[model samples]
Structures are given as C-alpha cells and as structure tokens.
Target chain A: MSHGLASRAGRISAQIGIVVAIFLFWEVAVQTGMANARVLPPPSLVLPRAVAMLGDPVVLYNLWITSAQVLLAFVLVAPIGIAIGLLLGESDYFGRAFKPFFFFLASVPKSVFLPVFILAFGIGFTQKVAFGMFQAIFVLVISAIAAAESVSSDFLKTARAYGASRRQLYLDIYLPAMLPVIVEGLRLGMIFNITGVLFAEMYVSRAGLGHLVSTWGMSFQMVNLFAGILLAAALSIAVNEALRWYENKVGAWRG
Target chain B: MSMRTAGGNDDRSGWILLLKNPLVLRLACLGMILAFWEIAPRMGWVSPVMLAPLSATVISGVTDFGVFARNLGVTFGSLALALLIALGGGGAVGLLLGSVRPLRTTLLPIMSSIYAVPLVVVYPVFTAWAGIGVESKVLFGGLYGFFPMLLATAAGVRTVDGGYMVAARSMGATRFQMIRHIMLPAALPSIMSGVRIGSAMTAIGVVVAEMMAATAGIGFLITQNRTMFNTAEVYFGVFLVVVLAGTIDWAVSVIERRAGSSYPRKVRTL
Candidate 1:
C-alpha cells in the first residue's frame, strides 16, 4: 500500500514538474530575448494578473455572463433532450431510424452555426445561449439514448414477469440503471455547453471572458491575454473535474 | 406444395418490404426534414430572411459556385495540411508515451486537463503569433486535432494484447518488425477513429478561424453573406461545410471498417 502511494506521489510530482519546467523555460526564454515577450508573456507576468483579475469586477462580470449562458443552455436542454432520448431508445424502430440523423448532426462542427444564430436571435445574450443549446442538445440526446438503451432487455422482461407496475419499473429499475450514464451525459453536455458559449462569445460579443481574451490578444496585451486564457482554462477545468467527481459518486454502485 | 403467395399479394408485400427497409426509413426521415426546409419558408411559417428555402439556397449555391469553389479549395488545403501535421506529430508522441509506461502515467492526466480547456480561446494568440492567414488557421486546426489523435493512439497502443508481442519475440522477430506487423494492425481501429475525430476538429478549427477573422474560406463566405443579409448564400455556405464534414467523416469510417476487419475483433473504439 505504501509502495502504491509512493508511486502515485511520484507520478503526480512528475506531472507538476513537467508543467513547472515548461513555465520556467518560457520565463527564461523571454528574459533572454529568445522568445518574444509581447506575443508570449512569461507566467511570472501572467500569474499575478490572473490572480488580480479574480478581484476585478469587469473580469468577474464577463466570467459571470459566460457561466450564465452555459447554465441557462444546460438547464433548458437537459430535460427535453433526456426525454427525447428515452423515447427513441425505448423504441427500437424509432431509435434506428432517427439515430443516424442525430449522429450526423452531432458530427457537424456546431461552431459554424454561430452566424445563423446571430442572424436569427441577434448578437446578444440570447444568441450565445441559443448557440450553447445547439451545441449541447445533440451530445446530451445521443448520450442519454445510449444510457437508456444500455439497460438490458432481460432485466425489463424479468421485472414484467414479476408483475412490476410501470411506475415501479421506471422508479426501481430504469432510473437506477440509467442515472450514472445520465450524469456522465450531463458532464459531457456541460463541456459542450462551455465550448459553445465560449466560441460564440469569441466569434462576436460585446461582453464575456472570450471577448476579453480576444481583445487582449488583438491589442498585443500578452500579459492580460495570457492571464485571461489561463483564467478561462482554470474555470473550465474546475467545472469538468467537479462533474467528473459527481459522475464517480453516482457510478460508484457499479463497482 | 409451395408456400408462395399469389402475384398480387407478393407485389403488395414487396412494396411493404421496401418501405420497411432501413435505408428507406433513413432516407424518408431525412426527406421529411428537407420537405420542411422547402415548405416552411415558402408557407410563411418562417421568414425567408431568417431561414431560406432549400430551393433558394440551392439556387444561391449554383449562382455563387465560383466563389464557393475557390474558397472551398483554400479551406480544404489548410484542412489537409493541418490534419497531416496533427496525425504525424500526435501519432509519434502517442507511440512513445504508450510504449513507455512511466511517461504515460505522468502525462495522460496533464493531457486530459489540457483537453478540458476549450482551445479556441487561444486562437487569437495564435493569430497574433502566425498572423491572420492560412498559416494561423493551419496551426490552430493542427492544435485542435492533435489531442484526440494523441489520446486515442495512446489508448490503442496500451490495449494491444501482450500474447502477440511474446509470440513475436519468441520467434526472434525484430522490435521494428513486430511493431509494424502486429501493433499497427491491432491499433488501426483506434488510430482510424482518432483520424475521424481529428479531421472533424481540424475542419471545425479551420472554419472557425476563418469565421472569426479571415478574408476567404467557406466560413468567411457565410459570415460575409450574413452581414449583407444574403440569407440564401449564408445557408448555402453552411450546407457546403456540412457536406464537406459529412463526406470526410464517412470516408474515415469506411477506411476504419476495412482496415479493422483485417484483425477482426470488436474493439469498441472511441
């Protein structure tokens, strides 16, 4: 057990060591004029700005806007997507007939539709949210269908033989069977949601973290740009890790 | 006695069978969507300006074929170059990491963490570095495609059966020969899936880069037309992109299937 813990610790240190080495290399490169500081600011400059930006109201507001759009899109799409998925999954004919279309849509790069959303909904909060919904719905639906369909037909048949009511079948069997996968779908959906919102905001937005990063980049404010990019990355990782944690919690019963 | 039905009954049942065909069902489903696309705008259910009719979009596509074809050539060129870079670099790195357990253990977590970061936010920085040209787009798209290929290839390599390696070694097979004949075939499905995803991402990155800031390409065409309120042309550009992406995805899957059948195991690859 101690040996296992030591190896894990060694692995983590190696990961951190690599990251630190990269940053240190960057810092030294910039100082020595080997790398252009204006285009690629060192972490020493970026890290402080990143920390300070957390207390900056403007930065905070942009973060909030992006987060709100993602949340709104997720909230609106999840129930409807799950319901459609369940129906399609439960019906073999409909599932086969419709799944191809769903897969095709999902495979398409949804960012290309940003302009269409802007045209239809205007370049405002609604447009960003709509784009997020567009990106997220397909992922959620596809995953939810997979989750629902994963429930064995034999289990359902056995339940029916035991005179289980429809309510009992759903409550006792389907929900428990599908919950972990559903949570996993939600996690993926949230990631897509973040990407969609960020893409839309970056493409053309008056306010948002994406816009802040873009603006900083355009003006050659490398420090601020680096900081903003780092901040966005941190937020995304936080959300992803949180969802992953929840996914593990829900899926623990499987083991 | 034969159990064959009468001619009239056979004809009716044949027709029913045709309707029941999976291909027919899929086509019918898509046909319905196309029908709605054509009818909705024409029937005033949706404004033509917001959603162009299918006919109008087709007409627009035909009329603007020169513009689209020229831009498409540019986008396709960049996509090809970006995909080449991504697959080459990612495959090499993945191979190294996968074969070396210590390296894989250290790096896989960091790779996933990086993947979680929506890499689009860094595009502007890429533009600043490479300029708003095909170079920037290629770089951005290459970066986008890199991760999936890396992760997938690594996973594929790691999952390779040890028995094959042991047998090859006992037979005095060289390291290079074993990897070439055994590992490559076994890992082909995963690598091909990586190609599939990588191509999609590369296309998206190139298009998004064009859309964000570019003078040419399919995405730029859509954005330019949208600003001018030429809704049909915008729809046409979008259709072209969807078609391009779909074709690439379909082609990769075909390649994957054909190559994967050589090894003949149901590897549930990503």
Candidate 2:
C-alpha cells in the first residue's frame, strides 16, 4: 500500500513538472524569438488574461449563454432520444429500418446542416439550440438503443412472470439495467452538445464563448484568443469530469 | 407497423416478400424522404427560397460539377496531407508512451484531458497562427486526428499478450524485431479502429474549419452559396459532403474489418 501511494505521488509530481516544463518551453521560445509571440503568446500573458476573463461580466455572460444552450438541447434530447431508442430496441422491424440510419447519422458530422439551421431558424439562440439538438440526438439515440438492447430477455421474462406491470417492468428492471449505459451515452452526448452550440456560435453569433474566441482571433488579440480557448477547454473538461463522476457513481452497482 | 407483419405467413410469394423485406422497407423510407424533398418546396410546404427541390439541387450539382470537383480536390488534398502528419507523429509518440510505463502514467491523463476539450474550439487559434489558408486547415485536421491514433496505439500496445513477449525474448529477438513482428501485428486491429475514427474526425475538422472561415473548399462553397441565397447550390454542396463522409466511412470500415479478421479472436479453453 505504501509503495502504491508513493508511485501515485511520483506520478502526480511528474504531471505537474511536465506542465511547468511546457510553460517554460513556451516562455523560452517566445523570449528567444524561436516562436512568434504574436501568434503564440506565452503562458505568462495568457493565464493572467484567462483569470481576468473569469471575472469579466461580458465573458461570464457569454459562457452562460453557451452553457444554457447546451443544457436546453440536452433536456430536449434525453426524453425524445430515449423514447425513440426504446422503440428501435424493442421492435425488430423498427430496428432493421432505423438502426443503420441512426448509425450513419452518428458518424456523419451533423454540423454540415448548420447553414440550414441558420437559414431556417436564423442565427440566434434558437439556432444554436436546434443545432445542438441535431448534433446530440443521434448519439443519444444510438446509445439509448444499445443500452436497451443490453438488458437480458430472460430478465424481462422473469419480471413479467412476477406480475410486474409494463410501467413497473420499465421502471424497476429496464431502467436500472440500462441507466449506466444511458448515462454513459449522456456523457458522450453532452460533448457533442457543447460542440454543436460552440460551432453554431463560432460560425455566426452576436454573443457566446465561441464568438468571443473567433472575434479575438480575427482581430489578432493573441492573449484574449488564447485565454478564450483555454477557458472553453476548462469548461469542457469540467463538464466531462462531472459526467464521468456521475457515471462512476451510478455504475458502481454494475461491479 | 402492421405492414411489417406481412412476412409472418411464410407465403413465399415474391410480392409479399418484397413488401416485407427490411432492405426494401429501408429503401422505401429513403424514397419517401426524397419524394418529400422533391415536393416540399414546390407544394409550398416550405418556401423555395429556403429549400430547393431535389431536382433543382441535383441539376445545380451537375452543372457546377467542375467547381465542385475543384473544391473537393482542395478538401481531400488537405485531408490526405493532414492524415499523413497525424499518423506519423501520433503513432511515434503513442508507440513511445505505450512502451514506457513511466511516461504513459505521467502523460496519458494530461493528454486525455486535453483531448476531451473539443479541439474545434482551438481552430481559431490555429487560424491566427497559420492564417485562414490550407495550412491552418491541415493543422486543425491533423490535430483533430492525432489523439485517437495516439490513444488507440497505446491501448493496443497494452493488449499485447505476455506469452508473445516471452516467446520473442526467448528467441533472442532484438527489441526492434520483437516490436515489429509481435507488437505491431497485435496492435493492428486497434490501430485500424483508430484510423477509422481519426479519418472521420480529420474530415470533420477540415470541413468545419472551412465552414467557419475559408477562402475555398466544399464547406466554403456551402456557406458561400448560403450567403448568396443559392439554396440549390448549398443543398448540392451538402449532398457532396454527405457522400464524401459516407465514402470515407465505408472505406475505413472495410480496412478495419480486414485488419480485425487477420487475428482469430481469443477464446478461453479449460
């Protein structure tokens, strides 16, 4: 146990050392003119600006807008995607007809339809939400179907034999068995949700994190651009970690 | 749903079989969508200004085939270049990390955290660095494809059987020979899967970068047409993108399948 703890400690220090080394390299390269400071600002500048952006009401508002759009899209996604997935999983004919379609849709970057959404919905909050929904639904539906399909037929049979009603069977048996995988899907879908909203914003938006970063880049505000990108990255990582934590907690029963 | 039951009687009649076949049903569904597309604008269900009829879209695609071909060449050329860089760099780094436990332990977590961040958000930074040209697009796509390959290669390396390593070491094989003959073959399936995902991601990165801001490419064509209210051209560009994406996915799946089939799946025996 002590040896394991020591190795983990070493690993943690190594991680920190590596991050510091990277920053040092960036600073040295910029200072030495080996790297263009204009394009690649040193961490010294970017980090401070990132911290400042955190306190900036304008930046906070943009972050909130992007987050709200993603959350709204996910809310719409869960029920509709789950219902469709359950239907596809339970009905053989539906599975045969739609599974491949959804699979194809999942692989194909649904962002190609951003222009259509922009044209139809206009470049506003609705457009971003709609785009996020389009991007996330296929991923959620596919996972939900897989989750449903993973439950054993024998389990369902036993539950029905026990006089479990349809709703009870779903609530008690199907849901518990499927929740872990569905949660996994939700985690993955959330990434797409973030991506979709950000992409729409980047392409065209009056206010959002994506717009801030893109606009900063265009105007050659290197520090702000890097900070915006870093902020976005931090947000994504945080959300990803939270979902992962939830997945582990919920899936503990699977062990 | 009721019509799906037509095959339950096992009548073996051609008409009933045709009606009941899953493939036919799938095709019929697609046909319905195409029919709807063809009729929706003309029937005034949706304004023609927003959506063009399927016939018009197809005609636009055919007439502007030269322009489409040129832009497609640009997109594919950049994708090819980007994939080459991603494979070389990511594969080398992955191999090194996979072979070294200390490095893997220290770096993998950091890399994955960075990976979780949608790299698309960083495209603007690339544009700032490399300009809104093929260079930035290539760089963006290359970065997008890099993580999948690296992670997969490392995961694959871990899966190499201990017996294989022991057998190689007992044969007095050099480290290079052992890696080339055993580790690489063992890792082929995982690497191929990575390639499948990486290629798709590379395409997405390039297309999205172009869509966001670009001088030329299929994605640019779609956006440019959208700006000009050339709805038919926009649809045509979208059609091409779908076809391009589908073709790449199909091609990679074939390669992955071939690689996967080379090694018999492991089965436990008492």
Using DockQ, give the best candidate's number: 2
The deviation in Å at residue B200 for candidate 2 is 0.8
lDDT of 1 by residue, B1-270 (tens): 143233333546664675555556778768988999999999999887788999999999998899999999999999999988788888888777776788888888788778888998999888889888899999999999898889888888888888887888999999899879877888887888888888888899899999988888888888899999898998889889989998988888888778777775864342
Q: Which ten residues in a row have the lowest lDDT in candidate 1 chain B?
A: B1-10
Per-residue lDDT tens digits for candidate 1, residues A6-83, read 888888899999999988998999999999887778889999999999999999999999888999999999998888
Cα lDDT for residue A61, candidate 1? 94
Badly placed stretches (over 4 Å) of model 1 are A1-3, A154-172, B1-32, B170-172, B261-270
- B251 in model 2: Cα distance from truth in Å? 2.3
TM-score of chain B of each: 0.84, 0.87
- Quality of candidate 1 docking, DockQ: 0.63
Per-candidate TM-score against the hidden true structure: 0.90, 0.91
Best by TM-score: 2
> What local distance difference test score does each model get?
0.86, 0.86
RMSD (CA, angstroms), candidate 2: 3.3
